[model samples]
Target: MGTKGMDQISEKKRGKNKLKSKKKAEDVVDDIAMDDKSDTKHGKNKLKSKKQEAEEHEEQLKRLKETQAEFFEYMKEHDEDLLKFDAAEFEDDADVEAETDLEDNEKQDVDVAKKVNEQKTITAAMVDSWCKLIKEDAKLGAVRSILRAYRTACHYGDDTGDDPSAKFSVMSSSVFNKIMIFVLSEMDGILRKLLRLPATGGMKDTIMELTNTRPWKNYNHLVKSYLGNSLHVLNQMTDQGMISFTLRRLKHSSVFLSAFPSLLRKYIKVALHFWGTGSSSISVVSLLFLRDLCIRLGTDCVDDCIKGMYKAYVLNCQFVNAVKLQHISFLGNCFIELLGTDISASYQHAFVFIRQLAMILREALNTKTKEAFRKVYQWKFIHCLELWTGAVCSYSSQSELRPVAYPLAQIISGVARLVPTARYIPLRLRCVSMLNRIAASTGTFIPVSMLLMDMLDMKELNRPPTGGVGKGVDLRTLLKVSKPAVKTRAFQEACVYSVVEELVEHLTQWSYSVAFFELSSIPTLRLRSFYKSTKAERFRKEMKQLISQIEANSEFVNKKRACVGFQPNEPAAASFLEDEKKAGESPLSQYAMIIRQRAKQRNESLVESDVIVGEDSAVFGKNAPSSDEEEDEADRNEKGAAAFSSSWLPGSDSKEKEAEEEEEKKKPKKRKRKSQAEKKQVEEGAGEDDVVEDFVFSSDEEDDLFDIEGDKDEEDDVDDDAADEIAEPETKKTSKKTKGTYKTWHKNYKKTKNKKKARVA
Candidate 1:
């Protein structure tokens, strides 16, 4: 209560003062030291988290690479052994095993199988759990591992060494589902990052950067250090995921079409690399991606993807196998699938891809390359060509594909025409059917048939000429013409002989019958019917005529070779020339005779119709008679043709006259009515004698002309024989000419004498 109390009372009085309130407010407003500390802690935490993420990504990448190595090593070293493993059991109702065929060849090693199964359990479970982690962090390495595992699982059941179909099929349903999840997560993540972008980053700094192409390209390797590269993880999961992401966001594809088509292209490039490596099993996923692009941006979109795929397979990569051609072919096929139902959505893509695929197939399977790598690549080439065939046939309306279709048809035709491998009979038959399908669909049978005919005519049928030999001729042996390129002329000849036989065998089916084609349904536009359209009719007729021509040509060839075995050695050649009244016999003539016979049977009037006859049509070779006396001589020759001259082409005019008198004695005058004569000729089958005569004429000219008759006085003998025939006509003509000359001379002499007399007078 004294001074202290008075001070306490003052203090109490001071607590009520505005100055004390001001001091309290100052204590409350202490500097934000906690906030600075908290900010520092928060920044440290963020940096730590980023570092952890980066390490995780790097570890995952390393794991993926290791897994890839292990998988390959296992495949190389323990493939067949692994098949001995008992397939892991699923629930009674879960039929994963039913979906896959795992043939266990090592039945004696049950313990080994069980051990392998036990070992796989650990890895499989690890993979299953790892895929779950991948969903949150979304690393490309994890995705790639999943992809490789997926393929390995798929190919587990595959016994065929290089079958690509095995790669697409999954052996483990569990593994496939896991890989699919990983792939979709990663792909969706990338798309979201690519499309949505960071709202507060450098993207907002520049309007051009935001509206134009994504600036993501600027941060390639540097960004990959943090985000990891999709390209490096070339596997099936990435392929499927990328496709699913792009397709699901097709509503946003316009942005890709405009500002980020390269992103789409990059995805395809990565997919192709994986495909080229033969690592990805689901190649159809990549195909769908390309096809979707074509459908969305049109086939013009085909170029970017094609270029990417081409680069992936051929550029700066170690994937130059013949099998890689199939991937390129598949990419090409993807473009041809459908831009739309309309034929107008830019055929440029289809054309470009087709051309690219053709070039790839040709270059990779170049005759030399194919020969060098044939055992390795023939099947691959066959597969690629089959894909090529399918791609070409996909274009039912060939108006847009005309330029492309012909080359494709030629390629298919060449397969059969080229030295066809006997092993390739199945391939050839497939190609033939495909070609027929193309012809039917496009209504381009004429050009296609022409191409096929030309294929037969090529000097090299794909391999070699059989030189007319038929059995076991490796049709492929005939491609190279000479020396260093080919081992020997004999080898080439054998090849050629084989191919010719194959061609004849194949073309024979088409040659004699066009009725099947007439009744067959032609593939055309979806709603358009191919029933008897003008174009369709034309196509059918052309096919029939072409087939007939091929048939005729085959017959000609067979007949030519038919006598090769029994050719009249050197001596008989001479006899064939002189006594052979029907010297120019030919199968061409035989075919003509047959055709004429058929026409006569069908309708006598049609024999005069302008049909597609062979080379010996009357306009081509017939020489009309010079005058009526020659005509009468021909008539006499025809009338007496049945009566042979016993003189048998002896050398002199006296003998010819005696032979003619004898022939006249044997001849009987019997001129039938026109209709009856026509009927008789038809009944006689248009004369096999005519065929023999034509064959004798042509064969002699082609093979034995100079060989046989060089030393013989054949010309003089023929001349003397003709002179004898006209001797009677000649004597009468000469007498008349002499009388006319004498009269003229006498008149001239009289005129001169009279003139002289007059002058004298």
Candidate 2:
């Protein structure tokens, strides 16, 4: 049984092995099949690619053959066209040819040479005649062919000594000019027709050649005729939508300007007139041409042209008002150039033009009809004011122009009102300069009161009275106020100081009566404050130096011719009292005493009321009756006895006198309360309580007992405690406070305050 099992197992193993062998053989066969399939697919793709490439090659060959055929056909057509023209048409007639041959042979030639020369001449003349005939055909193609033939004949004539061909030699300027004139005149219609066609290569070459020659000198008349004709052509072209013509004409005119100024000027004038009357499209071109002409001719000639333009527009015809204004503006720019020149000869004319321009501008400004001045000169009004201001300020020696002072000032004030923010420093400077000049002029100072008043009224009308005023006042308002307008307390202080400085300076030279009285009359407190506060240190120094110089040169001051007046009454002792009162001080009895004493020293008459002695006594010391009844009579008798007792002995001060004096000394001083606005400002400042740890005491305040003793002990304690807390935060806060305070104080502080409130809220 075991043997049998072993044999069966071997058989099973063999069966399994056989199956494995069969599977391997089948796998190999499938792999061979896939390889063969892949080969077949690759072969098919190769065949397809070859077929496409062959088709492409064949197509390329076909295109090549077609191109070749087309080229040959074109050549054939051109050759046929060339052959169709008979050579004899270009030749001279038989009689002329025979006479030329005989003359050539008779002069210096062998018979054969002469015959060859005659044949060459005949051929050239034939070419020339053919070209002429072709040009007459009036076709673009025919004309180009004729130009080519003429060029060829001219080229061939360089080597061949042909008598008729000699006509193609370089023509002299005069001869060439004449030929061009004849061609341009007689063949103008034909040329115009040709110009409509696309530009041929030959046409461009010929134009360039003609332009470069000296034909301008000899052919000026013809050139003018051509230019006139060109203008007509340009008009026609413009109608037909040919902008190139206008551009070409402008370019040609630019070149022509250098050679023919006078002619160019005439044409330009005509063009300007046409432009003025013609379409708006022509205006830009005309303006450009005129600008170029003006630039090329320089300023003098430009000025002349401007005058001419003005005459042409304004004086000659009844131009449309719009057009007339346009022309005026066009000429107005020439003033800039005229102002730059040294030629005084043109000044009168220029000034006249400026004045007229101003009138025109004024009229335009005041015009009821808006359309009348819509396109009128916009900048002229500003420039007119500028020019007037400049002129008034520039000629300081010309005092005869003093009459213009008020008018010019009025104009300046008006402009300042009109355009306060105009970006013209020179204009602003001109206004300043004019003021200075007016001040220096030997004329009465024109009170700018009305102008200033107008400005102030305008400001008030613009702004609400409850709101604080604007930061700066206009010059007009400043003039009217006869002082600086104080918008803020700081500004009021500054203005008052400035005014005081001016008044003090004026007072040192002239009398205080002259300076302070006029200044003090103005209603503005700022002006009065300025006059009162400023110390005349510089003025005093100047006066002292002047007095010393006068003493050294005593002869000049003492001379009879020098009209000296009495030394002005020492600034009227009463004036000081008035100033003090204006400064918000009480009227003191001592002020009256000083005044009376000065009057007595000067031996001037004084009124009793003008002097104050105590509260009830008059200056003459006569007893005045008391107005009280019986109690007044008793009190008066007691006071009178006390007064007599005090006067009897110099050292006698009774108990009643001492008591009265003590009561007076003990009386409390009245303090004025700050306004709500001022109180608010102070409270606001205190609310921003940013304490500085490292407090620095000012030198002036260091001597205070509270600051030295109390502050030092408290500061030391705070410093010791703050050492535990980082100092950096306190330092930063203090720095922020300082920077913020400085910026807020220096800038528009009120606006900043409002902003700060908004931010905090």
Candidate 3:
């Protein structure tokens, strides 16, 4: 206990001392942390207070400066003479004389200003006098006074109080119209006089003519005021004719638009509004003026022009039908022409639009949600695809625009595949048509045989038609069938006919190529399979005819290809039938024409019947005539229209007789039985002719057919032989190598390669 206990005590004491020191150190650290926290809080608070005070001081100073400015402006307006001083007192005699002359001129200007401000109304005579002064002496004073009045009048109702600089006091509507018309009409001549240039000088000449002279400065201010106010007035206009008139006049002054960049942009915005929402005549004039501005201003305004025009087109094309389709087509053509003006510049905008479309499509594909799908599956988006397709292909021969075509085609293909079912057959057909157009223009082959063949396998085709006779839906105007209209025989017939027509078109586009046989083989075989399996006699007849026509075209191309002396490996072989003019029309053109005519006639019949039904409803409903005679007259008119429209259809005699019998008998039971019999006939395929079992190509032959060259995505320059090819089915092992290659082009490969290299490094 002596030594051991002593060591134990020493150890215990040391432990206690360490614990006390550690606790004290912890307490001191806590106190120091609290003090530092409080000090930082106080510092932040002081800094914030200082900031607030400084901000408040700056605000007060700003308010004081504004007050001083307002006071000075008031003084200048009320008693401007008091602001002037005699600075020439220290100068020589010549300077004094010159100052005296300047004072006299200032007095004259004040007199002219007073005279202008005193006039309350602008009459025709006053306008004529001003124009005469401008024309005779090219007077800068007249220009300034009139432009000031015009600018003030444009904002007539904007302010509550009067403006001292206004030349006119009360600007009536008629007076404003007169001044606006005069300014727009005479702007060119006035600009020419002010710039001291001839009529034929370029915009650069006009801009260079400006100097430090007083007249030039005054002219600049006046012209800007006139142009800016013109845009303001144009924005408020609702009259289409007047807008057109104004645009027509303003287009002549586009040469000077380059000088005022901001005002020019505002004017383009206004023009785009009318271009989208105006009447046909108004839109035409607006587009013409836009084209002029793009040409006149060149790169300065072209970007805005293209972007605005595209936006307007998208907004307006949200609801296009057969009636508005022609106008939309014209707008698209005009847009394409505008792009062609500067393909290099247009490439940037085109790439953006194409990439945007691709991104939206990618999102839709990724999420597969209705909300996401709705964004891409609309008339606006479809028209956007067509528009960019035309734009990209219009300049595809040029390297600047060629790269965009592939990406745009990929977007179209993605949209077609987004909702690949019978319900979206019309949409699929539309996308395929756009892809076909791109391929045709770019000398690249897109294997759309799968899309065409997919349409044939839809279960909607084999389903029996409903007994009720509904209105025929136009596939061109619809993306998908509605619930009520989906079961109708008219939609079924439309789907079948549209599929056949699109297939024919797809084949015809590549018929003049060297690989026409390979291109037509898969589509032809699938169509035959569909023809044999389908129950509709009308559909079978169409498919059979289409197959025969495709075969004849293939044989025609084979005969042509057989006579060629060049080897298959040579460029001459690739260039065979490259010149379409020399290749003449495809063999399927006549068949395509006949199909189109029948479709047109069918649409006419549907429209007329719809009108008749609508009129009949109105005659028997609340809008019915009060007398029997009026009712009889309406019935007669409807009958006449129905008869006239029925004549457009095939077998008009049978339809006329049926219509007459229906009119004679008011029995519902008889009509019901007649509809049942018609339904039975449709179910049985009553119009069946001889079924041709011998197909042009067997399944074994299909497998042995030459492997198509197809499109490759490894090169920027598209090959000539890559014009047309039939891709193998996706399930085949060979297809794995070729998967998506036909759908894509070589534009994006290099980009992805560089990105991968960067990531690896």
Candidate 4:
């Protein structure tokens, strides 16, 4: 029976081992499948460790599940553009009914699809939100396959005699499946083939000549016609639904243009060439597509775009060709858009791109596009300035910009100087917004903000200021300026708002004014417009707080600037203050003690100013002098200062300011002043509390006993100087000046000056 049981136990163990091995085998299979699915053609994830793969897998799954509901809701909420092309395509009277019925059926199907998606997460529904979708999912892949299959079937299959449901399915599937085909067209994809495309002998010869030599030889008719056709092709392609959709769709993919760098380079080469030579509408549309892509993809598209800038063949010998330069300014404008993207590229790339951008912009500012003294030039300069500021902020690190910071600043500052006098106020406001962004990024932007403030101050300097915005224009006048156009830039253009916003932003960012800290100092920063918005009121309130906070911060920073090394103390200052109080020191002395203690702890060599009040009791003890000597010295100094009291000296200001000034003065100088150490030596024997009291100056200067001795010492020095020069040792009564008054000394020694000079020499 024992032998049988052992055999049975072995059998059981084998069964368990087999099951564990099977489970492990299954896990391995699943991991292999995940890896296969996760692999990209670019090999971005190939170097990742197994752990990282697992982490990414888990995160992707979590994010997918999290956004699944959102995707469904987004499908339900989304409304596609009405198919007006079909409406225009169908015009026959008999076919109108069929088309209308088809359209109604399609709308009903769309609503039903939306309802179905609203209830569940379908991978097919997520394709439309392409800007955010990056990762590949098996479910989504399966859905795409299903849709493509249905679309292909509906296209080729006998349609059951034009079934409306069949039509709807074909259209819906086509819309989603078409983007997955890696779509490109001749207009967007033909850069490498441009020279190779079949052309007549003359055309081919001219194309090769222009391509090899210079951008200017395109003056020949054949070359001009070919170039014009290219421009037409570019505009047509940019406007096409498939190209626009596919270009935008690429940005959503995880690897972006990295997989298709070759294709992207081709697209850029073709686009920039057409953009340089194209008409206004053609050029604008051409760059718009590239701009939208860059803005969405940010730095992912930067390399390809930059590669095109150098190799576009639009420039000849480092300068944009004179013929092409007419509309080449749009290239600069396009780069401005690119530079504003949320750049994640390295500093080296940013530096290179910005340098290239400056070069392109220099050539592109041809005669037609020069930033002239005109209303439109303002926007042109605004674009360039914004580009530089955004590039520095988004791409370059602060430390990286430090070396080039001032030159870059001067460039932006120069543009800002032109903004105030800019003929167009709308563009001026844009300058304000750009400056606001620059201010948010660095301290270097404050000068630009100040420039705007000056412009704002001169907004109505030349023009006769209107009575106000709401005041009726005088119809009787021969030359009546419209409020919207010619009135105060503030009242007409809403110009003051941006100017004030910039000023407030810069001030709030850098140093705070006294007005900022004290609300009464700046009584108004808001317009009391009739029926104002809640935003205005809320902004005013927030502005007030912002100003106060900034001022308080500036004050705090200023206080610590001298001893910033000690500000972030190793120990919390509050604990030290508590300890000082525990040691029975006064509140005023406690703060002084904390400051000195923190200073010493920081390994800094301590000076008299850094010593705590109670640490040097003897110095302050002599400050509180004998009462009779104080009265006598006070009486003498009062007569001297009484003559000059009205003059605003450092300590003795107006009556109201004197109290505040004395408090400010006393705190810093408390440890520095010399007092008669002989009398205060006894205070060393007293308690910390007694010494703290002896040292602190009372709030009222008159009632203050601690600071009187310093004033008397200063007064005595003045008396000694005057007495030494005027008093004579010739007679006893003259030397003594019996009354011991400066007035009495002057009267006694009236003519003794010549006698004193002989003895002094």
Candidate 5:
């Protein structure tokens, strides 16, 4: 049994060995199959990667070709405009001179010959290398090529279209921006070194004279080309940001502008366009550039600048309303400040413009035609008057602009008298306020109380307000109101309030004078008579408050006058309380401030309410009440009133303004007047808030229509000796006309004027 078991075990072991060998053979086949599959997968991956690499390489080549073609195309288009841009001109000047043996002009021509561009294509790597080279040595000959390329690139798509006016910027804005950044940031320094110009602190006159001499002509030609091209690009640009950026960046080059008169004039013209019409930020930078140019170029180009700015102002202010009023006022103030730079030069411009205004007024009066009246009644005329008035007031202490002030005041006063009726109270008040400004700035007494007092006597003030359609006349833009709305209580209230405000302002301007007691007598009496006689309780209250302030101020001045031991003719007596802080300490001024602050708060509250109502209406639907909607509706209604007024008033082009009104007239009378009560309520509220803000809340001395803030620290360097020469005749007249208090006021005013001029110097 043991032997049988051993034999069986051996057989089983042999069978097991055979099975293991077979299993090992199967495992080897499986390993071979797996290897084959892995090899196949590796081969496919390798083939795919190779194909991708080939495609990428082709793409890079194609991209490089496109870039090269684009650059070559740009060069082809603007090659003529680029100086020293051709390859043939790169020959050594000494070699050309020796080989040609040319004359002086021919050798000079060789000096400015077109330069060779080392790199034919403008690739990324090539640009980088060029930048590196420029950084290392700004005086490299390659810089001219780089600059030419930059100039051509900046205006890449501007002239590509068949119509040169159509701009199709195909190149990305990023590329253009990069070019501008590189050039603007580095070109000034590079140019200064290349032109052998000194640092910016060097005298502009020295630079101007240096640039004009024989040695600097070649450099000046290059600079002029560069600057002219830069200005041309600016002229074509419409983006406010780009214009602002260009002006700001180029401001550093103003010292060089003195050498290029035509370029300076062109730049001034471009800047004036922006200053008058661009966004606020752009306007600021544009004005800064213009100021720099004015300083650098001096008086040679100032007249043209002044005229262009005035024209710009007129053109921009054609459609003045409350929203743009402040901006317009700011522009005017800046314009006056610019004028203060070269007062002697500006005097002629001011005189010319003021004369033009006067001639227009005179023609209007003589012709008595609608077209003539239209010229005087428009926003342009009003803004022009405001502009010159500000110019006068700004330099009131300087005799150079004093002569313009009188005629400007006359034009304004004539405008006030042109339409001597209750309907044109706003225009009349505007004229009076301008007069008041001139009077205050020059410390002279002007008879503006007559204009304000005249409004109180008009039938519009005494009539009870009737129900009116839409927001009662926006007296701001209303030259005339022929609608029954003029008879409304809201209009009456606004009219009376405006009159009272102007009266107080006119009185306040002279409240510090030695003759204040005398000046207050007539105005105070007229105000008292109007105050007691007015029927409206609100108007009466306003009049009473103003009268009380005037009386109190009169008392304060009288007391100060009583304490004055010196004669009224003495200089000390005339200069009493000339300091701003001391002048602001008066009860009248304190009251004015309080009224202005309160008015400001009320205006803020009204604006917030308007905004809230606007938001709610937007959230709702068309039927919902909205402040913006109400304003639009009111605008239409006022337009209708204007159209209606134009019909009855002789010389008005009634057909034009009546277009929108014709549609409204077709509606039922009841519906036409449906919102009369609502409109009246709205107007009453708005009038209560706006009248005070318009009149009492105005912080500046320029115009009641717009509040213009002056820059007290504005540096307008004046020639003191020239100023004295100009003021000599006026000073003699003042000395002759003055006897007691008037003479004292003149002496004090003269002293203050000298100090102010000294500070400016």
Candidate 6:
């Protein structure tokens, strides 16, 4: 080797030396091979320990499994023996069928006791088997079938009037109650599925047939009893807030509503009897159930049920019961729903019944109850009226059914009649207010008019003897002495006014042209107008005083006028006199007079100077310029006079024309003078006509009484006119040149003549 090769080998040896040195450093720090050996050793130890533990656990499980199997086998054998015992308790189906056949054969032999004994034995055995199955297996289907079979045997026994043994009766009630509990427990599942199946039409026929069959009567009772018991349980569940499951079951049950009616009726009767006797909760439940039944069974069924219920209600005379009130209110609400359905005749009948109920409530209002009771009774009265109104609106027109308008009118009128004498003023007011509201909304003007007319007629028939008539009997005295006495005269008066106001308000808003036309013929307007005028006068006096105050305060006067858009005009008398004096004077007359006076003062000619004077005019004229000019001057004079006096012809004096002018002037003045003189006569005629017409047509007597102030105002106005006429003559001389100049001159002449006569006397 050369020196260079030796150097290369030395470098490579150094690199290899460095790598060996790094490996030695790493190995010295952590003993890498030893660490790996220890890790492998630890992993093997863990695996060996896990294998040993698995073997031990497996051996323990085998032992435990053997023991559990042995224990389960023993328990199974015990269950099997129990099942055998239960099976033995049940009469075999062959024996049961044979026994039924033997009983049938015995029935033909008239051996009723033997048949009863057999049925008792059979029912007892079957019930025992059911109890055992329920206790041991708890298979719902097996239990259900066994109970149904046992119930069927009891039903058959009941049909034959077979006397059941006490043991069997006890077992049957327990077994039935148990089955009911089981059914209720599974009701949500079973009933939902059962009801979801599409209905076949035959179920109704089957139900009808079962209802009619004497043999199935017992079955009917059993079914009803079962439902009754279940309902009671469900109610208890509801009270406890555990009703979710049961309510769901009831909602899905097909026969639940159908089966509820008979039971509900029975329950309602009993509940109503005990209603005030402290079973309100049960009564409430009965009401709710009946309401549900009405909703579910539809209108026809509900209507029939209500009719029967109403009879019972009447028979019991339970109208005074608050619970009855609640019950009837609920039934009324349900009937309202039925009214929304397609059946209209039934709804009309329902409305009629509601009216009857309202009448009963009206009577109850007179009862000596607490203030709250009276208030509630009043509310119920209005509620029933509102419901009846709604129901009537919902129904269609039917020929067989009388128009709902008349009955509703009567009910409202009856309440209106009652409210006045009702002890509570606020209650009376409330009832009357509701009547007014209903009258506004639903009452026809014709019916209302007729009702008002009838009331008025009754009033007339019952009116007290007046002074002119006899003995001066007032309405109070008449009512006091009447056979059927009036209650609450003040209330009756209030009701009358309220009803009148309602009628007026409705008539003002509703344009019943035909009814309005009929009313027009009856002379209600004069009476109504009189009432309005009287009422208006009271307002007018207040307003007049207010206006006078405002006028006294200039700022208020201006502000009020601005607010109300009022601008008072000049007084009529002053304006009339001012215009009258200037009537005959032309605009140009005044101007020409001013001009001529100025000219005369200035010494100028009134006429314009002409260039030529004609010889013919000098010969023929006294004051003519010329013949032709004279004619022209005369024509100008005539034209000027014509222009001023066109309203009256001149230069043609006819007696008839003069007399006509004189008559025109004289007649108007005379009429003005006599208008005041005739004032009382016109008023008397109008008043007499009004009173007689009111009596003839029998307009509302309240209106007649309230209208006195109005008639007095007319008389006052007449007297005021007479005063104005008396004052007219004193002012006549100052206004002599006016349009009434002739009348003014005549009045002045009469006054002067009177002064001369007084002086002579």
Better of 3 and 4 by lDDT: 3
List the candidates' TM-scores in order: 0.29, 0.24, 0.61, 0.29, 0.61, 0.32
Ranking by TM-score: 3, 5, 6, 4, 1, 2
The digit string of per-residue lDDT tens for model 1 on 1-761 reads 68999999888886665355455334322322443456458768764333343344345435534654543343445344532322222232134333332234344367675765554432546676656666677665665455545444423433442343322332244444444334433433354454455322122123235454555454232233212223322322323433333232222222333344455565555545544443233344444444455444544555665555544433322222223333444443433443332355435655664565466546535643433333222344444455445545665545675566777776666555444333233344445556765665564433233323333333333333322232222222121122111222333333333323333333333332222222111211201221122232433453344345454555544544445444534544333323222532432333344544643353333133332222222121113111111223354333233222122211224455679998876663333456678888787885332211101123223221211122244334222223444466988999999999999999999999999999999
Off by over 4 Å in 3: 1-119, 157-161, 171-178, 204-215, 466-469, 574-586, 603-761
Candidate 6 per-residue lDDT over residues 2-105, each given as its tens digit: 99999999999877865665554355324534644564687687643333433443454355346545433433554445212222323365467667887999
Residue-level lDDT of model 5, residues 84-149, one tens digit each, is 233333335435654565477686766654221222224445456667888876546556656664
Error of 1 at 616 (Å): 49
Q: Per-model C-alpha lDDT, please?
A: 0.41, 0.39, 0.67, 0.39, 0.64, 0.41
Q: Which parts of model 5 have CA positions greater than 4 angstroms off?
A: 1-120, 158-175, 201-204, 212-218, 255-262, 468-474, 563-572, 576-585, 601-761
Q: By lDDT, is 1 or 5 better?
A: 5
Clashing pairs in 2: 90-125, 90-126, 91-126, 452-476, 452-480, 496-530, 500-530, 500-531
- Model 3 TM-score, all chains together: 0.61
For candidate 4, which ten residues in a row score worst on lDDT?
472-481
- The residue pairs found clashing in candidate 6 are 580-738
Off by more than 4 A, model 4: 1-241, 244-265, 269-304, 307-378, 398-405, 419-436, 443-445, 459-464, 467-486, 489-493, 511-761
What TM-score would you give candidate 1 relative to the actual structure? 0.29
Clashes, model 2: 8
Model 3 over residues 139-246: C-alpha lDDT tens digits?
877887678667765666554436665447665445555566567666666776666756533553446455455666756766677667767767655555556666
| Regions of model 2 farther than 4 Å from truth | 1-217, 233-266, 270-288, 295-304, 308-346, 357-454, 457-459, 462-761
- Stretches of candidate 6 above 4 Å error? 1-138, 141-185, 188-225, 231-288, 291-304, 311-331, 338-391, 396-497, 508-761
